[model samples]
Structure formats: structure tokens, C-alpha cells
Target chain A: MCAKDETSRPKMAKPGRSFTTLLFFVCCLLCLLLTRGQKDERMSICHLSSCGSPLADDGKVYGMCQGRHGLQVWGRCCVNVTENTHNFTVGLDLSGCNIHDEFFQESPLLTLTHLQALVLDNNPITVLSSEAVAGLTELNYISVPTHSNCSCPGGEEAWNHLIRSVNTTLCLKQTSTCTRYNEACPASSSHCVEDGPGLFLCLCKEGYHGYKCLRQGTFPMSAFLAGLGSSTVILAAVLWVLLRRHVKTA
Target chain B: MASISQMWRQLKSKYSIYHVFVFLLTFFSYAFFHATRKTFSNIKTTISSEWTPQFCNATEPCLRPEKIWMARHLFDSSSDAEPFLGWLDSTFLISYAVGLYISGVLGDRFDMRKVLSLGMCLSAIVVFVFGCLTEWIHLYSQPVYVILFVLNGLLQSTGWPCVVAIMGNWFGKSTRGLVLGAWSACASVGNIIGALLVSQVLDYGYEYAFLVTSAVLFAGGIINFFALVPSPKEVGLPEPEDGDDDDDDSEPSGEEDENGVTPRTPLVQTDTDPPVTFTQTRPQAISFFQAVLLPGVIPYSLSYACLKLVNYSFFFWLPFYLHSQYGWKETVADEISIYYDVGGIIGGMIGGYLSDRMKKRAPTVVTMLLLALPSLWGYSASPNNKTINAVLMAVAGFFIGGPANLISSAISADLGRQDLIKGNSEALSTVTGIVDGTGSVGASVGQIVVPLLHKQLHLDWHWVFYFFILMTLLTAVCILPLLVREVRSMKCFLNYQLRRQAAALVQDTHRPHSLNS
Candidate 1:
């Protein structure tokens, strides 16, 4: 019912407690004050390294590190991400491009019509938080391929569970051939037909139709018709604008 | 559910008395340790004032190749030292590595209070030992520092694990990493404190700088040992507050059940793995040596090595790089170092805070690391004007320090969420040694690598910056997969640990009947 110290050593203050104890007490007070003052002066410190002051560039400002390094601008951060779309894919390869992290949540990645596939493969993209995944809906594919080289062989499965729990089809894997949660084989895997998680492959045997080559890429023309319908809105806007200008001129 | 007043009372009962005393003792000892250790760099002006005449005999305008050699006083730079700084890092790294595993294993094997106290005692003794920095008397300071650092690395490692073990027993896992990491942000606190002390006495005395630091370390060690309780079980308290009915606690509990047992109530380590328990399970328990090396040491080593490259470079050369490149005075360099430290503070706290809040450690780490990569790449691409550069440096510092602080501080403790080391006193120390010693080696390589890269290319200092960029980028790549594995494994590990604890609890209930009958 009770947990107690195992050792039963007699409690006697160190032999010179009276004399040194006073000195130590004062010293402790002094350090606490000194350290406090030090803390106040340097209270801005945080986890990642950052520049101390802002570097003014004509009208553009950048963060300047004490070590003479230059930080990127927010606008530049956007540019950097956009310009290196391929790099984001590499970020995928590196597992350093989690779209669900704050970068996507806080930044204008949502408004950036330029971003295509949002890859979060191998990165800790397990967050199903609403904000973290909000901007990610803009992308065509949201992949967070789980690492196969894990202590648990079911990383993909867990990842699928996380994605599924959110009720979003943001793929957390590159191929639908996740060896977890569902029954689908990867397009890349040698096994043309195998059951897997979040993975689907159609291994068309000589005359098959869908998955397992049975359905092929043939959707009833209605899916393509739906895709065309979305584009018509844009064309309608352009035509409306052009007609308004013509009427005003006439 | 516990009320806020109940929590306040708990804090009062726990830390109000003895812990306060422990805090004060630690605070002072740490001051002396830092004050004395860094004092040498400041008094460069005074020492050179004394020795300048001998070197520049009446004519040649003191051609020492170093900018401020003869006219320099204490804490000033010396042409003589430029070459030595590189190898000095090596000395520290090699010695630190030599005892890396031992420090962790031994700290665990023995009473950590004793081990930590001794580490502090030696840091103070050796710091003062190096106080008389004459050519001959201080020759061994580097290697002695290595030994000191290794032990310190080991000792400081003791800090988190002990705190974790206690906190693990006292608090829930929900806020443990956050609190520990917030506590871990003390590293930045230590650095800033070291810098401040340097600023105060840079003109006064250099040796006292280190000696004071040693004293502070001694004090902190004493406080830690005296105040640190092994676990809540040891202190006779129930597991964390507000546990009665919280929705957050439900998922973890369920997660634990599916895999067999409920994942340990997020953070708090239940009263199970005492020395007696460990001994009782001797035949059945996983071997300490095997567990130490397999997943524990291996991951720690790899991550440590990768991070070391970045850590060592930033810590040792950041100030110098600022001063030399920006034409900053000593005061300015010291002041500016705060930016990096400040970012680290935020990173440390946020990294842990967010992880615990979300109940996911690996996700936090991976997210931060991944986010940091672009920042690192951006920071590295250019080093144009000073103001802009400074701003980016702060941002870079945030990305680099935040997640790093999270892992090194709180996540490391969480990683050892296993049976043998669950809330054990030595868990943090082992992780620290594994992470920090490897970081030391990275520092050593940066010491040599950056300088050599600059030497060969005759390019701008950006070359050195380039080296860090590649290192950070590479670190992100290598760790990405590993962390994914960790996250997946952790899910199961949590299940397994909970099952083991729950099973043990059940067995303990059955034992009374069997024993009495």
C-alpha cells in the first residue's frame, strides 16, 4: 500500500553545514537572481535557431542570423515551396514534406492553385486535425506513405486508419498497395494481384475487366463528363466577362 | 476529476519545501560553474596586455595574423588559438565518446543521485583544475574537458530521466513531455546564462567564468540529487490528476487494450518497475544490456550522429561566425547568441507541448524536422544583407532548435517508454549520452569540416553555411524513415508496455491469496 525509500541512512546534514550552509544559501540566492537576470535578457530563446534582428532590403525584409546567415521571407517561403514542387516530392522521398503540418495549415498553400500532389510519405503526418489537413484538400492526391522499415510491419495500416478516421481520401501512401487496412496491390509491386491496405491494382489477366484487370481504365463516360462540367464554369466566366466588355463598347 | 486547487496543493506539498531548497542550491552551483568556465575567453584583453610586449619587440606592428593578438586582453582572440580550437573540439568529442555508453549504463546500474553528484563534483574540481590555464597546466584541459563533458554529458543526461521518472510517476503522459521539455529548455537557459555571465565579467576574469559554471553545476547536481524523487510510487501518491473521466484518456486506454493492454496513461509510469520488481523478474525480464543496445542505443546513436553535425557547428562557431563576418564586438556576438537560444526555447517547449497535447511524439518530431528542412535550405541559399540574414537566422534557429530540443529533451524520455526503464532514474541519462555524445562527435567534425571546407575553396563563409545545409537536409532524409518506423512501433510499444503493467497489476492482486494461504 505504501512506497518508501529502500535505503535507511541516518539523516545528518553534511558535517560543515553551519558554516558552508550559510555561504551556500547566499550563493544559491545570488545564482538564482543572476540566472534570472540572465534569463530575462535572453528570454526570447526557442527550439530552432533563429536570427536575432531583421535585415532590411530596400522594401523587402529578411531575417538575419547572428552567424551572418539570411532567413527566407514569408513571400519567399511561398516562392520556395512553389518553385521546388519537385523538391516537395523529394521531400516525400526524404519524408520531410508533411502537408498536414503547420506549414500547410498556416500558410497560403490552400490558395496556391499551383500545388498538385500533397505528399506526406514517411513523415509523421498522422495528424488528422482539421486545420492541419484543411489546405491539403486542394491537392489532387494527399499521400503519406508509411515507412515499411518500422518495428511494426503495419505502418501503412495505421496510416490508413488515421486517414480513414478523418473521412478523407487523402492517400497516405504513394500507391494504393498499402499492405494494411484494405485489399489492394501496388501498381509498382511485382505482384500484379495481391490484397493490401489503401492499395488497389488491376492485374488484367488476358481478358479481365476491373480490379484484377476487370474494370480497366474504362469508366462509363459519365465521370469524364463530370470533369468537363467543372471546366465549363471557367469558360462561362470568361465568356460573360468578354460579352460585358463588348456590350459596354457597343 | 481533480480541481485546480488540488493541483496547486499538490505542487505546494511536493515542491514548496525541500524542492525549493533543492532548487536554490542547484541554481547557485550552476552559476559558479558557468561563470568560472567562460571567464577565460573574456580576459583575453588582459592577458595579451601583459604578454603583447614580449611578442612584438619594438617594431614590426605585431604581425600575429590574428586580428587581436598582442593588444588583446583576457577573453580576446589569439592567433595562437585558432588552430587549436579545431582539435580542441576533437579532444572533447573523443573523450566524450569513450565513456558515452558507460555513463548511461553506470548511472542506471548505480544510484543516480550519487552518480550525478559525483559528475558535478568532478565538473567543479576539473573546472578549477583548468583555471590555471598556463601552457603546461592547461594542456590537459581539452582532454580533461572531454572527460568532464563525457561525465557531464552523462550527468546532465541524469537530469531529464530523473525528472521524467518522478514526473512520470506524478503526472500523466499527457503533459509529461511538455513539462520535461519545458524543463529541458533549461539548456538554452544554461547557454544564455553562460553568455550573460560572460558579458558581465568578460573584462573581469576568464577562469572564474568556468569555475563559477562548475560551481553552478555542482550546486545543480546537489539540488537534483537531494530533491529528485525516483517516482510517485516512491513518494506515496496516486497516478496523475483528472484521470477519473477525461475523453483524451479514453483513446489511449482503448489503444492499449486492442494491442493487449491500455497504453500507459499517456505519461505517468505506474508503480511497477522498482529495483525489487526488476530483481524479481530477472530471469524473465529483457536483459538490460540487450535492450540498452538494440533499439535504445542504436536509434540514439544514429540520430545523435546526424544531429551532432548540426549541433556542434551551431554551438561552438555560431558566435564566432557572427563576430567575424558581421564585424560584431564580443558584446554583440554574446547578445546575438540569444536569438538562437530563444528560438530553441520556443522549439523545446512547443515541440513537447504539442506532442503531449496530441498524444503523439513521433508526429511532432517528424513534422518539425520536415518543416525545418525548407527553412534550412532557404537559410542556406543566400547570405546577403545583415538585417535580413539576422531575421532568417532567428527563423532557422526556431526550426532547428525547436524540434531538436523536443527530441533531445522530452521525446528521448518518451522513447524509453519500456518496462525496464519505464520512469527509471537512468532512462534520460542514457538517452542524453547517446544523443549528446553523438552530437559532440558531430561538433568535432564540424570543427574540422567547416574550417577545411573554407580552407580549400577560398570561398565566402557561405561555404561553411552550405555544409550545415547539406547536413540538415541529410539529417531530415535519414531520420524521416526512422521516425515513421518509430511512430508505428510506438503505437504497439505503448500497447505492449500497458499490457505488461496491467498484467503485473493483476498478478499482484492474485499474489496475496497464494502467499497467505
Candidate 2:
């Protein structure tokens, strides 16, 4: 087999050994190399019909699409935006829509945590807790301001602090949820500091912190006892099984 | 004492021990093959995202290019990177297809254990080097990436034939369909693992995808080297009766019984005879063309080509289509697409089990391919509901996965044992290689054509799916001749039996008349 291969090798190398063959190979190589450098054109979310309301809709707000006018919008609704929203959807403008609490609850916006600028400028929406607005740490520009009726559990002072931490220029004030302060802070808490007419801050005496000052700071003795009991039971069961096997063998 | 003794006995049993080792070692070894290949899709996405840095930057200025796609000038000069990336995949696949043929030949002549392990190790080294070029050193040459991928493709080709041939040696024809079916799921398992690994590490650095995958391949190679026994004889166990052992002069004389049949050496020795020392020779290697000429080889090969085309198109493009057509988030699209593979795992087992029970490989495959046509059409035309899509994807997966697994593994094994080959066991690997090699060519074509079809159809995903529906129908058609032949043989068999019964009745009447006379 080795001798046969050796004889065959020289025969192949002897023939078709021309400059043109080498040139043809080089040309093919060149074409592939040239084509490799080419890059695909970037796709824009603004071009997609799912990014904006259809033109046939009764209320065609330019703000919904960031004032990019004259773009063609077919009759495709953004029905499955969580599954349909483009990865590059940074600026979402739902400014003039009457988006109530149900809108937030039902909308797929929560899944689009990659958003950079979320503008709910003039909507009649009230945020009751930081929990409602959490998980979107990637947001650079959030505009749910006092003017838009957007408020949190913490009053104007707390809202301002939230805005500062997010590093956005949106100034949202405390809402009616703060005015009903008796129910806001837990009864077992120590002091409630009112910043404004509608806003109050809870100050727990000790061994407690949180929005309602309801969370106990100390570790739970019951959980410790339960863990200890379970471990002991498991250990005892294992030992019993081992002992039974050993006794039988003996 | 009784419990301990029982436990030890169970461990010493054949079905409970050695066979399980062979099954797992082969299963994971092939899965590693798929795991390494699975990284391509994720890497493709990374390349596209990186090429459009300006767009990504506009979305979020802080976002950086994936290190895997940071190789300069590869996609920077062109208007679209899809064409180039498609070609890169094609280069790998074409080389792979070519390498499959060569590897099959080598596997026949050489020790499969070494071939498979060395292939894995080389594949690991190539992938590791490829990753380092992209991530650590940032080597920015198109030729470098292309050449490395092509090399990896050739190395990757060695896995399927070697594992299949080794598996064929252990399990008999009776249980082959079911065993191979379960075993074939390594591809889907590897796909899930690869997809998950890339997605998880994608945020950290794209290079880790390749780095981690290379590590897996290396570990698999090491395992393959140590754990894999190419044939049952290597471990002093009985080779399954495939009717080929008579022609196999490779076994030492000491192992042969009085009738000259080598009795199956039990995996665990019950008798206290001293361990037999035997020098076993290898069966003569069959030629490539001869292996291809074996009965059922050509038709199955052609059919497998089409099946692979459809399957691989989904493997590479399903996520991209979901993302683009429905405007789905990349991650969500990736998650949803795994349903296809999940469906495939179940489909493979079903296909294998059905074929085994029916004892007709071609007809079983034909049924699967026929069923798959409607599933593809339904999936394409169905609404973009997640639950509906999930159901449809699984159903499609079952039908397609069944035939794909059946034809390549069990059917190939059956064909390799055809009387035309004189039951030469060494030819099984070569036949497997030829059939799957042909399929890999279709896979290569799929990698190229799917993208082109997507381009030609103006990026409408519906038309792309229509093409798949057509391919499924074509695959069913390829198996029609085989199904026809099986039916005819069955009819002939029935006719012969009826004639013999009629003759026996006549003989009974004539005997009574003669006795009376």
C-alpha cells in the first residue's frame, strides 16, 4: 500500500503543474478573501411595523415613534411585543396614551429590560412601590415625572432620590398613596415622617427596615430550629439504616 | 450481608455493567461531536451583531462588540455579513463531507478507538486555537479563521462513523433499532448543552464559548481514549451474532469452541479458568466504493441527504427566523427554538423502537418522512402563538427526528450486514460513513441554500418554511423505491409459504391412496 501510494504521488505531482492552475487557485482565494471583509447593513427598529401603531389606527401619535414621520405601518399590531420587540428598541415613547395601572400590569414592557430611555411623559399613571419599577437597571433616561402623575411609596424627597440614583432628569412627586399614610407604614413601626401633604416616611425603632418597616432584622429562631430538627432526623435515619445492615452482616 | 452481596452481583451482571459503559461512552462521545458543532449558530449571531457595531452602539453606547466577531476586516468592508458567514459554514461543511468519506475509509483500516480519540483531541486543539485567535490574540485574518474551521470540520468528521461502527460491533441487529435510536439523541443533547453554554458565557466574552467547548471536547477525547473498546472481543466479551463472525479470522484460536464458533466470552467470568491470552488480528478493510454498493446503501444515503438538509436548516436558521420574522428578542428566540431539539429526542427513540418492532427499516423511515411533510407546513402556516409554536415544533421534531436517526444509525447498520458484503463487520463503519457523509453534503448545501432562499424570498420566513416542506416531501419520495422492494419481497415470501402448504396437502392425499393400493 505504501509503495502504491508513493508511485501514485509522483504521477499526480508530475501532471497539471502549470502557472495558470496556480493563478486560478490564487484568484479563487482572492475572491473569498475579498468577500470576507463585507459587513451586513444594520437593521433599524424604526423600519418595523411592530415598532409603531398602524397608520390606519384612529389615534396615530408621532410621539409613539419618536417623531419619525412618514414611515410605512402595515396593519400588524405589536400584539406580542415581548416576542416581537427588536433587541435595539432603546427609546420607547408612550407619552400621550391614557395608560392606567392595568396597562403596566398587562404590557410586555417589563420583559424589555434592555431599554435605555423609557418615556411615559404625560400618562395618568401612579407607581405605588419601587418593586413595581425594579429590574430595569439598564435604563438611562426615565421620564415618569410629577407632571405625568407618576408617584412612588416614598414621597417627593424619595422620588427625587430615586431619580438621582438613576441619573435621569425626571422630577416626579409623591401621589395620593402617600396621603393615606396610616395604612402605608405598619402599625408596629415607631415613627412616620411626613415630607409633604401626601407623603410620609417610616422610621422603625430597631431591628427593622424596609418600605413598611415590617421586616424583622433579627434571624428567625423557628427556621434555625426547623433546620436543626430536619438534619437530626436525616442523620438518625442514615445511622439506623447503616446499623441494621451491619447487625445483619454480623 | 445479603443486600451487599445482591448489590455486588447486580454490578457484575452484563446488562447492568459493561453494556451500560459502552452505551454511555459512545452516547457522550457523539454528543461531544454535536456540542462542538452547536457553537456555530451562536457564533454566527455574534458575528452579525458585531458587524453592525454602529447600530448596536446607537441602541446602547456602552455595548461592545463580541470578542468572537472582533476579528478586524473580516466583515467590516462588506455591506452584509450573512453571505460571508454562510460561506464560512459552507466551507466547514464541504470539508466535513469530504472528510467523512476519508475518515470512513481510515476507520475501516485503522483502530476506531485511536481514530475517534485523536479526532476529538485534534478538533479540540483546532477550536482552542481558533478561539485564542479571536479572543486572546485578536488575530484579524480571514484566511486564518477559514482555514481553522475547515480543519475543524475534517476532524469533526471522524466522530460519527467511529462511534457508530463501535456501537454496531457491540449490539446485535435485534435490538439495534431501539439502541441506536436512543444513542442517536446525543446530537440533540449536545445541541442543548452547546446552546446553553454559549448563551450563558456570551455576556462574559464570546471566546469563552469556544474555550469551554474546546475543554469539553478535550475531556471527551480523554474519556474516549480510556473508556472506549472498539469491539466486544477487545474486552474478552462475546461479539453479537451479525452472521459476520465466520468470515472474521481475526479472533485467536483459543477463543473458538469445538465447532469452531467462538462462544461469547462472558463479560464477567463465572468459571475459574485462567484468563486467556490471545493475539487478535483485524478483519480485512473494505473499499469505499464496495461499501457504497452494499444493498440499501445508495437509497438510504440519498434519502439521508435530503433529511439532513431539512434538519440542519432548522438547526442553524430557526432562531434567526424567529427573531427576524416575529421580531422576537434574541434570547427568547433561542429559548423557544430548543423545543425542536426536545421534540427530536423523543422522535429518535420512537423511530428506533418502531423500526425494531416492525422489522422493516425502510418502511418505518418512509412513514416518518411522510408524516413530517404536513408538520412542516402546519408549523409554517400556524400563528405566532408561543404554545402553538412549541407544540408544532415538537410534532415536527418527532417525525423528522425519527427518520433521521433511523436511516443513519439502524438502517445503515442493517445495510452494512447485507449478504452482498459477505457479512464483513469492518465494512459497517465505512457504510455508516458513506451514508452520513452523503448526508453531511446535504447539510453543507442546507447551510448555503437556506440563507440564499431567505434572501431570494425577500426575507419572508414563510417561503423559507415552504422550501422545507418541499424537502420533506422529496425525502419521502427517495424512500419510495425501498418501501416498494420490501413490500414485493414480503408478497413473494407469503406466496412461497402458501405453495408449500398446498404441496404438503397433495402429498398427504397421494400417500393415503398409495397405501390403499
The candidate maximizing TM-score is 2
lDDT of 1 at A235: 41
Per-residue CA lDDT of model 1 for B416-437, tens digit only, reads 4444444333354455555555
Model 2 chain B worst lDDT run, 10 consecutive residues: B61-70
TM-score of each: 0.51, 0.59
Compared with the real two-chain complex, what DockQ does model 2 have? 0.01
Give each model's whole-structure lDDT.
Answer: 0.46, 0.64
Write the residue-wise lDDT of candidate 2 on B122-141 in tens digits. Answer: 99889988764464665656
- The DockQ of predicted model 1 stands at 0.00
Q: Which pairs of residues clash in candidate 2, taking residues 3 or more apart in a chain or in different chains? A: A38-B78, A39-B78, A39-B79, A39-B80, A40-B80, A40-B81, A178-A198, A179-A198
lDDT of 2 at B106: 93
Using lDDT as the measure, which candidate wins?
Answer: 2
Candidate 2 residues lying further than 4 Å off, grouped into runs, are A1-250, B1-16, B45-74, B77-80, B243-267, B270-279, B422-425, B457-460, B494-517
